[model samples]
Target: MPYDYKPYAYHRPPGLTAPEPRHKVAIVGAGPIGLAMALELAQHGVPSVIVDDNDVVSVGSRAICWSKRSLEILDRIGIGARCVEKGVTWKVGRTWHRDREVFTFDLLPEDGHKMPAFVNLQQYYVEEYLIEAAQANALIDLRFRNRVKAVEQAADHAVAVIETPDGDYRLEADWLIACDGARSPVRAMLGLDFDGELFEERFLIADIEMAADFPSERWFWFEPTFHPGQSALLHKQPDNIYRIDLQLGWNTDPEEERKPERVIPRIEKVVGHRDFRLDWVSVYTFQCRRLRNFVQGRVIFVGDSAHVVSPFGARGGNGGLGDVDALGWRLAGVVRGEAPEAALAAFDRERQFGADENILNSARSTRFMSPEDGVERLFRDAVLHLANRVDFARPMVNSGRLSRPCVYPLVAPDATGLPEVSRPGAVAPDAPLADGWLLERLGVGFTVLAIGCAAPEVPGARALALPVTPELAARYLGGAGAAVYLIRPDQVVAARWTACGVEEIAAALTASREGRT
Candidate 1:
């Protein structure tokens, strides 16, 4: 018998109408954000269809690093442990000027933080895990080789025209989300402009397998001598694989290519005469652009479709994953009939705020990566030297503003006039439980914290009180006298108070659950 090597696109049988008149969310592009949104919806028992044009998982390593915040989201969906197994934790990194080492700072030792630093993992691993989990989820329909040909939004529902191997079909959904890449068709379909400054420098990211004397630690070389305009960054992944990013100066040919010999020369310049085999190499330009708006009618933009920043600060992937975490829970609520359509609007206000902050951080990182001129480089070097001498100047050397998650002010009023414990804008901080459990353990669903009182007698909420264990309490609650914090399903703070009162607690719950003041 002859072998049949036929290529055909894949598609789901057909989407059933939502059980009730629920908000149906149709996600385009089954990349990280799309898969993450599917997992989030599945956890909440909401129905969703995840469609993508690419039939197979990605081959290249696009996002090789995850921030402290991204890992927490994975934990909630029950993949955090698996992710930890495949990923390596980096607590410290060194900044360099040519061969000279500058000041080193600890990223994990900050006050009230659970994890020390970021985790370096292959982007494909994240997608692999999410895909596996989504396949097991009965509520989520994962459709591969299915592309969104067109999107039409109506007052009642948004319709997506899907192009599969079989043919094109129309899918009517209550909402359409775009997790597509930089050149987003959905964004173009809606006639939205991605407005921001663009960087002209070209860069090459190469992953290599090596067995040599290279440093196993993370290092960033600032303005190396071998290439006057080039800077090199080395990150170690699982197995003897390392991700090497080489800045290939400004004003290069668009068709300028990178040969293995050219890449090996740069690698040898940094890691003294070490033998290594290159695995994959890709060259691309960088940009710092974001869409003018995130939400248009029933459709919303997310991931690279919404914003594209220079990879200097590692904000490109991190920012998009943050969008998945933020929008997932709210979309789940709307689909589950727990919230109104108005709740979808908050996705715009919140995600746009995050996008704005991260892009600015990317711009700052770019400034440090490629300084304007010799004068700027001299000024930066002097500042670093001064940082070494002064105690307080260390933070100035390391931009504190860049490391932390951007906090958006709560627009609606909660039980307390002050911000709720894990309000929408705030990054969810860890808390303690009387049972010696970390607050993150309760992240699978919405958590309510009641302090200085008995656990609330609510049907859906689980509460904790003050005067916890000496060890566990100190580890999380930030000391015994601190107030209680109610965490949302998305791992964001919901509400907090010095003492728990039924009325105040109820108000906090109402605002988060109903999206109203």
Candidate 2:
């Protein structure tokens, strides 16, 4: 059966009758990114108003792969465990050429982390979980059918003219985060545009319901006999539904191909049976693009509003989550006056760096998938052919490069001889702490995890001391003696040092809060 779609009820806005107080933060979309931002701000004691034109979760099964880093971010916002429980976890991905198997890779080669490498949950489910989380939080004021018609950003704040069933009204906020997806109204009102390449290839993506016991693994085929001279990808999702993506060259009419008459036969050839029911179908051409800058005055952009990439790399939503992970804390701190507003420039720089990385990876995989017929096809085929026989050539296979958390380039203080896993700029890795996970103990605040020393008395930061258990010692300590590690509110490692006294800890915290190197 096709997944049932339900819309949430909309009510009259409180501001319809009279003016309301300006919000500290206003988010302009109720998608996963915007809701997560609101919840994140709420966690930091910052309340926000979330306005959206739509009143439901996603209608399509778009963006099915959630990365581990995204899961970690979700964990902080209170939906991580629920998402994991409902999602189909998979780490092994296999690639094939024609009839021969070529390469296979395991994304999660290690353990001790709270989340898996990837989880196959539909975008709608994720949004549902996020909405539930936001609704449960008292700080988030969700307004459905409240469409943002115009936006004006000033030196100190932004004002959005929103239209609702009742009437139009002005919504003022110290900062406005746009999560309005690929076609962002905020971006248009500000007269800004994305800069990057738009690919010429088209693809047919479908969700089919079947009881087949296909293992939970990503299977990609290049020039398979069932779909000769093109690429096909299959992923198992929850509820016995599978997502299949097939390449359709530039000449193919998307409308004609989307018809059930055309789609069912193509799927039948691949599955070798007519026992499946089609749930949803979409034809799309992807782009790898991003804004010139994510932070523009008092208006900020997150998720698809900030950048977009091809599905092959799973970078689309995952990249947006990265924006959420990086922006939430900085914006929260600035709103509360705990940090200078100049720190937003650092968020702009680091997230752009991450966007560039996603674009580069997605573009390369796309080129490999839809290579030109002459030398490009020859070289691609040669690589795929050689991959079957040699280990060295296997890495050349370009199934969508899976999404991973990007480590920003930060010049914060660091202690030499420490393990590189928990380096500055990277997310503080998850580990076991007695009966619970290490992250739960750290909480959502600036933290100093002191090992081999007494906990420091740093103002405005939480301090936790840990004895060197074998696992903690290996992952965090690594025989580097007693060290003090500073963690950001977003749980990123700000700095670490063996002899980081209170003065140095305060300096690292200052640099981190100020967004300086």
Candidate 3:
């Protein structure tokens, strides 16, 4: 089948064209976030150029876990199936104390979704898969082994001066994105302050090929038998590869702890066997940090560039992935002329919320895993034990605690007069359709969903009516409430009314097209 490549509704100015002008967006890092953003733009028929300093695709597996929300975003970009094939699905996790299971939770059953609880795939593999998916589109161009020497941002465009192996060149992009990791040069060039704390303790992440009798489940040994001061986490990866995280005692030397041979012997003491062959071992001291702002001027930071979460709950990579998914659709709108330049402000507000929330949750999880003092550890254990005892307690702990789903309150509204619909930031719920697709499937475009009512006259945009049945009514809107909801291209609830009148609908659609309320 021939590919469908639709041009953006708005075109670049014709008079100001360079001989080698290629794409509209310039992505600074070729990591997962940058790759995902490029693929997202490709789906919208908007071209982008991904520039990176690495000569080849990243090899080391810096990230090892994926959450449910990340999986859904991959599916939206049409690469979820390939990712599932390469990753190992994890549904249950065991919290071990003194080599005995204390708490075991089934993550998949908790969500009540068809998707798995989490997947353990090497970060490099995920990057490779996305890069391959990007090849199908003419919009994504990968420029590797090129260091960006300078980036000068103007109101309309960003000029990146890159130092390639051959020579120096200047590249211009309408908008620029920074997905570079923790030591972000782009952020430094912009003179942004990354304000946060760094934990003094270090940990060793060792990848090994071992024959073990342990069950294939995620295990976190909080209070372990062999180590009194340190905790251990054993996560199984693909091809009999296992990632073992051994927390270094508070005073262990970094140089001595990172040496593979030295790290292996310490791991052997805990496992009671020295049979496993170690593949790679690296010692890392993680920090709990967050950027002051996710967006500065026209340059936006995603993933590690935005925040650095300790590897306690595996939130660093997952949090970054969420940032790209949240920002991609909105940025696409600005590029396509469906939204205004001010729409970018909402990206800053929403991602800042996500970044702050993830940072706090990860900090709490880290504290629980490795409590600072006696009083803190006691409170942590008591909370978990209490949760196990009471039903209501479990819900309290699970309230936006374990990454169920994120609902944003509108900081910037796209419509007016509908107080219920104009709430600051709300993600439209995923409504399953009769045809087996989802309401999210309609997200690739500007969608106006008028539930149970005639297509209310949205003067400037496309509106899709969600047939309001008794079942649909009970699920989405209350019986007394308006069955019709206007959904924006970004899958945000725009304007909802009890009745989708022509005037109300038109006003909502016009505001969204104009990109503000």
Candidate 4:
């Protein structure tokens, strides 16, 4: 079965003939991160121009797993539901050794949350949904077939030379965001380099469509009989498509391994027959690396351009979305003149912290999966052998840590009574409200979520008061009395206090904007 990769119509830009005024923000790349970043900005009433080299969504099922935190960000832009509806929802993951089950884990144990633990949706589908939703937002000006050849950053603005089908054009933007993926031209143009580890191991990744009744759970095998000594992972996706990854040692030639002849046999071994059709196949090596800083003067890097991680943990895409969430409020505030230029420093500081966390986890997973000979391999094998027998050893097995939201450390006001889930510096947890979910009630702006009490009116923030329900009490109030929470536009808790006044709340808001807190 082949995917219908439709091409988007590219409108001839006026920049080719005449000089246009400077745009507030110019985004490079139209993948998930760039599109999401553009949409997030538009939600904050900021217009952006997105320029990409290609018109079609990704050809392969590149990033298939969308974390709950990513879904929450997508929900903010009104595409979360659509993604879930078209995605395969799964929570359970099992690990096996030589056809024998060793460990099983549930991603989400409790209920009541609207989103599942994770959804397996192809990259193209997610991009198509984002592109469709973006078209409705007039603030988003998408230009396809426009590839950036060179970029120069001035003191206050950035200039890019885009080579379009018609001709080359010069576009200037106040802030140029490079979401241009792993091999970013913008980063290369700036002569910046990523500082981290690149694993020598390679894995053959493939998407197969089959009509099988496999349970919607992640199945991983360590030293599977079919692929002896190597690891294997299976995940279910929408439209009867299943994603399979087989560990091909670093010695194997990727070009030879990706051939359909070689790939077909691997699929047959995993599925037990030649009943499945290969939808997509590729070979990739893992790397856990990121830039020293996300921001560089008038130019900023987001998504893969800023950081990259192994696919094992699903951190690459989700971590990029974290960059979007952290950047949206601060960049919007800076562009809108509501916050100082120093606010972008917050985006750099917080997202850098996130990149570090992702790198640490991903690096560990990579090492566990691809250990060297001697003590490393010995310990890895021991953990797998003992994992089936003991509970403590099970935790040592690192198939993939899976993506989770990184909690940024905050120095804002707080109290001990509130639950740690909604503590300052964490994304505000979701609970069912009367009209909608707690996340739905907190609109795109600076908000004060007051539980069990009236919210204090801050100078430039919205105050949302809610009656303490059981779920709300459990998530937000804990054992404490009425409290106020200062939430940023991205639904991140900036600060919270059990007895916060207007002055304190206002100061916290300032700190959040300045990236100080």
**Candidate 3: where is the Cα deviation over 4 Å?**
1-19, 110-114, 211-216, 269-274, 384-405, 411-426, 429-434, 450-461, 465-482, 495-498, 509-517
lDDT of 2 by residue, 369-456 (tens): 9987799889898999899899888888888888887887889988889999888988888888777888888887889998778889
Residue 67 accuracy (lDDT) in model 1 = 78
The model with the greater TM-score, 1 or 4, is 4
User: Model 2 reaches what TM-score against the true structure?
Assistant: 0.97
Q: Tens digits of per-residue lDDT for model 3 on 1-517? A: 1112222122232213433573478899988888998988777778888888874555556687887667777877877767777788887777655555556677665332434668888887788778778766778877776678898988878888877656677788888899989888998888886787776777888888776666667777755777665678888887667888888856878888778768777778766675777766777876778788887777888889888877767677778777876677778878888678777776777678777777777666666666767898777666556665666544323211355434565423233343342233565645456765444556676566666666565655566766755445544565354556666655666666565467766676666545454
State the displacement of the C-alpha of residue 391, model 1, in Å, after optimal TM-score superposition.
3.5
Ranking by lDDT: 4, 2, 1, 3
lDDT comparing candidate 1 with the true structure? 0.70
Which is the leading candidate under lDDT? 4
lDDT of 4 by residue, 195-270 (tens): 9998999999999989999999999988899999899999998888999999999899999999999999988888
Candidate lDDT values, in order: 0.70, 0.90, 0.69, 0.91
Q: In candidate 1, what are the lDDT values of residues 1-517, reduced to their tens digit?
A: 1112233346444533223233377789887878887787777777788788887666667787777777777777767767777787776777666666765766676445455368888877788788888888888877888888888888878887778777677787888888888999998888888899988788888888777545545777766786565677888887677888888867665344477767778777766677777777888787778887787888888889999887766677778878887787887877777778787677777778888888887777776666677887776667667765777655555322234566766653334333333444576656445443365566556666544445665445666554554433443344345456666666666656556666766677767766653
For model 1 the local lDDT of residue 245 reads 86
Which pairs clash in model 4? none
Q: What is the total number of backbone clashes in candidate 4? A: 0
Task: Name the TM-score of candidate 1.
Answer: 0.88
| Backbone clashes, each candidate | 5, 0, 8, 0
Q: Ten consecutive residues with minimal summed lDDT in candidate 4?
A: 107-116
